[model samples]
Target chain A: MNITAKAHEDLILVTVGEDRIDAACAIQFKERMRELTQAPSSRVILDLSTVAFLDSSGLGAVVAVMKLLGPDRKLELSGLTPTVAKVFHLTRMDTVFTIHPSLPDGLQKAG
Target chain B: MELVFDSNLDAVRGGLADLLDSGPLCAMEADARGTAEIVLAEVFNNVVEHAYATRQGRIKVCLKNHPDGVLVTVIDSGSPFPQQQLPQGLLPEINAWDDLPEGGFGWYLIRSQVRHLSYQREGKHNRLTFCLPY
Candidate 1:
């Protein structure tokens, strides 16, 4: 799995490069996100533009990251492919996190 | 035949995709193909992670294409899971950020994606079967 993190003034944008994020990479993905968001940032935007598939474990990882960020920090999801978006909708996670159409949009909203 | 993967999830997915891409099973439509791939990846990930605990183990994937659809059976001698007894309901009220719960959504995904789902434990072996209509 390839994960790239770009830090902005108030937000960090992380792009997931893997086509699928399941049990195999869920732990790694969560740890990487945690490391990226450790410093105090206004928000975190997860760019899933390349992710084609996600399972329960992957969802759990994202949820865990949100909890780590807590109420003080905002977490947004952007560029969810059709399949990945379906999972979020099915689990009703679309209601939990702020979903944006793109990273720029998410950052703009957060800012 | 029993297949072994060295803790590589993509390799297992690729192997399954190759198997399903050939023979009579290749006739599956695009939607069915997508659902089948998702189901396969979910189950295979379960076997590799929960069952084997990321350790080395053997996964037996049996595929059969019938007139109705395609049947895929996964058998592993790893940790046993009581998937049959899981409660069935749509918890739309429960938000994702709420209190964490265990062993609910994975079964939901499996039930929702596959046409049929059944689990059996024959002694040490845990067998899970899913069918997809072509």
Candidate 2:
């Protein structure tokens, strides 16, 4: 559950440095996300490029983070690997959140 | 391919990595292999969470090549399913933002990817079988 967050303008870009988010660390992931997202940012984009695998528990953790963000804030995603993308697609969570193919152009260099 | 490990999340993680890295699993098409890993993880972790909920136990996973796909059998010396039945695994209805689901996707993911799923309580052991199609 290694994640780094940097505020770029109005949004906070959080990158997951771990390769897998499964049952083993789902709770840690959620806790870490809560810590990283403490700052008031309208948008929080999670960079999952490094996360190759995410199980159902991990998906649940992600959803919980979104709920924790509440109505005014948003939790978006970017760079979902194949396996990770499959989980989102199968669960229909892909429709719930706004997804980006990669980091935004201006933020790519910062990430 | 067959392997047995103690019932725990870390062991489930390590065992899944080993299983996906060896033998027929590694040689599978990327999509098929990914599907296999996803299905197996959901199934195995379900056993770790539910079957062995209150006590310690062991889980055994057996894999074999089938004409249509790969056959998987998981056996665990843990509690039997309540009423000796498998869950229907209906996708949780997505309603408002307040009602968003935080869990219950495990069996849905497994059922979506695998076929010929069957379960049996053999004395004290729970035996579950499914096929991952390539």
Supply the DockQ value of model 2: 0.90
Worst 10 residues of 2 chain B by lDDT: B90-99
lDDT scores in order: 0.73, 0.93
Q: Please give the RMSD to the true structure for each candidate, in Å.
A: 4.0, 0.8
Give the per-residue lDDT digits (tens) of candidate 2, residues A30-52: 99999999989999999999999
Q: Give the C-alpha interface root-mean-square deviation per candidate.
A: 2.8, 0.6
Q: For the second chain of model 1, what is the TM-score against the true structure's chain B?
A: 0.75
Model 1 lDDT per residue over B1-134, tens place: 23444335766766666756775456777657666766677677777777788466778877787666788778888778756342253443554554644224665666777766778888988888778778
The local distance difference test score of model 2 is 0.93
Give me the TM-scores of chain B across the candidates: 0.75, 0.97
The TM-score that candidate 2 achieves is: 0.98
Rate residue A58 of model 2 by lDDT.
Answer: 97
lDDT of 2 by residue, B57-105 (tens): 9999998999879889999999999999988888887878878999999
For model 1, the stretches where C-alpha displacement exceeds 4 angstroms are: A105-111, B1-30, B53-56, B82-93, B96-103
lDDT of 1: 0.73
